[model samples]
Target: MTITQKIKSLPLTFLLLFFTAVNIFGQKPNIVLIISDDHACQAISAYGSRLTQTPNIDRLAKEGAIFNNAYVTNSLCGPSRASILTGTYSNINGFKDNISYNFDFNQPSFVKALQAAGYQTAWIGKMHLGDSIPQGLDYYNILPGQGQYYNPDFIRSGNVQKRYTGYVTNIIEALSNEWLDHRDRQKPFCLIIGHKATHRVWMPDLEDLGSFDDKTFDLPHDFYDDYATRKAAAVQDMTIAKTMRMGHDLKMYDPADSATFEDNIKRMNADQKAKWFAYYAKIKKDLDAKRPEGRALTEWKYQRYLKDYLATAASMDRNIGKTLDYLDKNGLSKNTIVIYMSDQGFYMGEHGWFDKRFMYEESFRTPMVMRYPGVIKPGTAINDFIMNIDLAPTLIEAGKGQAPAPVQGRSFLPLLKNQHYTARDAMYYHYYENGEHSVSPHFGIRTKRYKLIRFYKRVESWELFDLQKDPHELHNIYDEPGSKPVIADLKAKLLKLITAYKDTEAAAIFARAI
Candidate 1:
């Protein structure tokens, strides 16, 4: 009750507080980064999409933090990945878009960073960052960018070239299992498990081809956005009506569709030409006898799309379960930090579009789930804005190490543990659409209530929407005089963000003009 009595208990009280904090935040948990290509958050069951079946992805959210507001700096494949790797934006890393260019892996990555921090690093499956896989990535079976879903060629460490005969998911899983079985167990491991699933021209294994044959997929509400105001949306290379390639995706060029073999052969050249003709010959012969009709036809394509995407994901989910089982079987789950995420969200018939590039809600949001054994209390949903670049700094900070220099993203370690933590006021987003495809360039910033977008080039326009009122982003508020003041404020913040992220193009142009 006296001052001396309180002073005598101070050391014990301090020791108890320190121990409690330490127990809540584990020291150096093994990090497992599971990234999927173009796997939209809408596809995962955890995000409340009832269409697809993804139990493993659901389990991660059930066990740890589910980041509802997770986003990517760049919505495309390569640039977003560059942001993920370096914890910086596309302009800073020089991988602004996906073109004939490749990402320079020589730069600092989370793999090299964790490896430096005494963790054994391995990258399995798709590393669509660039062709050249850097040296210190412990084990690699990466497919440069958008590797084949069937019979993919895997490049092992010993310069051995081997053609994997099974589906890509199966191959990736097998290789990852091998790496796990043989990896140095004494040290903490950082395994980067990437899946080349649910990308364009979706292909499925023969066994899974008839899985979703009976289900009729519900079309999205905005499946037919006329693009009258959003002209840039009309010029995309992935329009469902015509732009989606028939031969590659729609199966319109199958030999059965064409009466003669020569007509089928017209689209092919050399080996790829012959291979497609042969595959088409078999399927064509089957179709000629009895063409699929009415509900059968609808079911056929549904099966094609469903099995094609889900089969790949099925293998991935199984393999993820394998990894989790390994951690548990080996008594490592208690000390492991597992994260499952996608490069960016993809269109599942939304806006009648495919691929990721446009700054829509589906493409803009990515699936991000983290399970840090002792640190992150399970089932915490963080509604604040989080992005791709933040993953690295968060990992470094969680490992009881100081965050390195040149990280554009801030760590959300506080939000992970503290339920009452306040995160960023606004999340900045910018995606350049001039790449191999003719997707128009654009940039934007999103707040909880308002969104500001600026389309590039001739007669550039600004789009402002109060997201609270227009959650679907169907109506443009930028033109309305009532939203003008709000637009000005968000635009100023967007410009400030461009400067903060070292967006060189915006800097030079805006500075000289303003």
Candidate 2:
């Protein structure tokens, strides 16, 4: 029989069920995915932050689900973003590191799937995909590179560059709202708003310059780690004590260097420049008077770094609130699926490090929260193992489309419904960036209780941590007498995963480590 004839002949109860299924499956939800660069989970109050509070970000957790164990396939910026876009690992996507590569926008992505399925897609803010514009996007306005703190330049849809005249975070938020204003209301849309806040050389809005001045941040317990057992950790150069520069990172550039401060204030109009200099003059005066030395100097710089970082984060959180408020006031909250995440985890002075390249907990685990009013229960939290690669599959599933065969990620929709759902036995991570921060290229497997890493290339070494015993990863027990069986099992699993994922290059490298 024809579908129309069958529907007309069906009994009332049967007809209701048939139409209900169609309504439920046919009505795709609008998606708003907000990603910020180098934002550590520990920095968000929703994730139990100790440094600062993020009320707007916390709102997503209160209204939806929070994933506590979300990680990235690779911890660096470009690699992690590539993994998200392609739903595959860095090796599979072909953008393994932060330099000398362009993302092949021709690759099949979840965005393309959504577009094909009749959804309007838009990308705004710091995509960091590559030098060129990404394909499969209907509209986009992105920063040229890492992006500047104040008055950054953005490349719009036609490769036209426009310089915005405000704090980067605020400008990104405003542009997102503008895009939403002009978007077609009839079709379901997928919008990604990427913020450049909380990245390197953190710069706060002028109004937030002294926001954290009264509060003192406590140093991490392992701030003075000697790296006694791990040679890989000992030889790295990301430590804040020695590597964080005063001129570039901490904003203590010489006053006589007219160009340094001028570049920051150039984009500001008269009133804006006046306000900026007024706020900065006080900080410069304090530094000049103190002239802190020795451990005191390092501690002073740490405090300065934390203050600016948290202030920048505060501005980002405010913009998040603005976006959420827009959805609520416009009556788009019920059918829209809102998500807040970071490209990857960042180091927040944990282990006395300020950059993110290692396989440590701070850099490897990212923050993820989602709000889908009817489908997801409010105030829910899940501890399942999830990765950035899983995002593409999840979005595709949410949009009522199937993930393509080439995609390596699995959808976490089941876990959202039932937190105890078994997803994967372990997660894999590989960092291929060589010597940018003096960190060795490495690959590892992280199970529920153990983490095994092989730091190769410049150094052939192994490190194993029993997370149940040492959450801080202070001691590497790779050479401990009783660890032979555990190490053997992890190594076998690692090899199997490497081969299964078609990471042929990594497999060859793993053979040498074994």
Candidate 3:
């Protein structure tokens, strides 16, 4: 038989198996996914922020592509991670909030797909999914919970908890490099270096302490927003003025007075504690001497908060450079795909808020930069709508593997190749952790120029913003005179997205709202 006739005569099952194997083996790129917790795009210089400079992070953008409109399905920690791993929304993955809940490790993760395709997988640092590490990972060294900033206890492979005496960011980088050195060189690997810096109670590395003291950080344009018309905005308790505490968040607690600070540093070794105490002692002294009342104090707290947060980020950026250097030294830079992203976006004192939950631009938009030597062009900026849910699917496609049937996220590989390619027109989001920051559990849809949200759980409120006209999301134009048409259109789109995504609960809630 001729070649075409012989192939046609083959069994259908055999053909399917042959193609699947061929796809898996076609392109075996090593993937390094580095994710930071609660790090905002506004803090990165590549994202056009003047607050701080991140040369290492900017290097990724200078050498690769920077996404301008990357977002998350849920703007919380655990849920966003679940979305990234499973290529599904929080509702589908069953980790809709940060509250205590077990992640179903049996689910089909892209890491498992990579492993099955002859790739070694490892996860280092903070995988804040839960107590148990997910299956299919060859090695893991993760923090027990949120993980500590100083002298953290890491749960290593085989469930062994080991306490390392060092700054969390430095330790994470050291462990990541160690793993890279020991990983099997016979196969391409997928490693996730999860950083615990720039999270809540932002603690800087001792070396980075007082790094931003000379810079006078400016307050956000809407720092004094009164939430005049937006009910949801007015009621949230995450404002830096009221919610961020001096002792807890700003770290202004006197080492000798505040038991919380004393207990936190107690885990550190003598040298670590001594350095920490000595650094904070000066901050405590300055705070006590300049006891400005009212708004002055609030502004002082904001300055302190921003300085500490930026210092933490500085260490993270430095470690990123170390990882990149490892790849270059090993001659793996040409074949490795390095990705840097945050679990979700954070509020950098925007709207006077310090935490994330709302669908506002500051909290909703995440920073994502990727470097794949030959595939993605240098200095490329993509404005397409991409979400955390799309991460797994993209990785699978990059590995020359197909996304599973249940995956809801679409790979933006086409856009990476061609900038003009259009991705999703609208993105969906759901925030379920309510009452934590006095934020109502809400769901919404964001188009390129418009955003419509329904704060449903506690208070029945609707907010619509013409992002083109009001980029800061300061106004609630849902009930405005000329906004009826826009609101109706957005509602229709939101319902369609909910139905298409199989969000049964959100569909029902949206139906009642309409």
Candidate 4:
């Protein structure tokens, strides 16, 4: 081969290389899934939230599809995540609650399927599905359990624990950017970024301290809701009035006491600690001066909780913007699909509750916004009944991978594309936690117009709500006069859903009830 001959062949060689690269990476869209912990739809401005502005999250809604009817199979963190990964309910996934169960890595997962199908995958940040390394990932760096806010420790690949000195949300953003910068560009990739902001003990970033303090939050219309006929609601322990602690939750603590608060903040560096403590010190001083009692104190706590929660969420939203910016700057936005959602919806004083685990709307419905440039039209509002369990199949389908047979969730990719879509008549929900929050184990079904909840075990009672009339679920019309036909139809639908989903335990319970 002479020099002239080699030069002539160069064009063909370059063309072959370009075609190879296209074949490897251009066949499917890359996915970026951002899952924040316990982020309520009410906190996002795009979701009509008056409490706070999540401009970054709103950007996703503005540029893509915002799902109004997104829900979860289970409301708890671990169980919800398990459902998301496996596209199956807690009953089938075997992670019923965060307390008693560890996620079985051996189970069939969409991540495993995607990886097997030649896509690079990684999960970074809060994966609260136990300490075991998550399955089917090229890389993983997860927070242990609920994870800390300040100077948090992350469990990386090889089960190595490393402490990163900064706000958890910011650190996650930095790590995600780093991964995006160095990931193999020849292959399609899926990256799931989990955030620990806005969870319990809402700790804001140094700059975000007291971000929402200037604004006074109006309590929900049912902030002082009386239990009335809702037997399950009457017995739960998750309330801002009682369950939230002053020192731990609201940052109202005397320096001399409150070891739990100390332990929480011990990881902060000297400057971080000083800035944090000094900010809270003023709040404590004002609290001591006022000495608010009874309703005043409860309202005081609610105000603080909202301020801290929104402030913490501000950081998460900022990080989300950073991620979106990265994608746009790198020209990846055209082919990349960005999804932002909470593991499950949270309570902003709805029913005077603080935590999730009930079949109530606040905890059951998650905030989901997705951006797929060519596929999903900008500002498209999706009102179909989509659950967290559908995430695995949807992403799998988007990435050109197949979900396993055991997966129960159907892909909502059609919904995004405005294709022929058949909406489910009802969605099933089950919460298996009998412990924390004292919420009884229960299961129910939610349709477009109605929600039928059966509080089993400790509180064996039925509560039905006409969501069209009482959007807040204030009235339990299960045994009301002239409600027998609706109750019977809902009961039959609930039983059918339980049977269809293969929840043997729920089926047995339903049989006994019938």
Best by TM-score: 4
Measured with C-alpha atoms, the lDDT of residue 253 in candidate 4 is 65
User: Model 4, 350-400: lDDT tens per residue?
Assistant: 999888889899999999999998789899998889999999999898888
Error of 2 at 272 (Å): 3.6
Model 3: CA > 4 A from native: 1-27, 260-263, 419-422
TM-scores across all candidates?
0.85, 0.93, 0.93, 0.94
TM-score of 2: 0.93
In candidate 2, how many clashes are counted?
0
Give the clashing pairs for model 4.
Answer: none
Clashing pairs in 3: none
Candidate closest to the true structure, highest lDDT: 4
Tens digits of per-residue lDDT, candidate 1, 147-227, equal 776667777676566776657777787787788889898777888888887676665544455455456677677767776
Per residue, candidate 2 scores C-alpha lDDT tens digits across 1-514 of 9988977988999989777667644589899999998999989999999899999999999999899999999898878888888899988899988886788998899899888878999988898878866887899999987888788999989899999888999999899999999999888999999899889878898878889999988988888788988877888998888999876777664445554555654566777766755776678789999888987887887888899899989999999999999999987887889999998888777888888888899999999999987779999997889999999998998888767888999888777766455678899999988878789889999999999999987667999999999999998999999999999999999999998889998888888734
Residues forming the 10-long window of minimal summed lDDT in candidate 4: 254-263
For residue 107, give model 1's deviation from the true position in Å. Answer: 2.3
Candidate 3 per-residue lDDT over residues 29-53, each given as its tens digit: 8999999999999999999998989
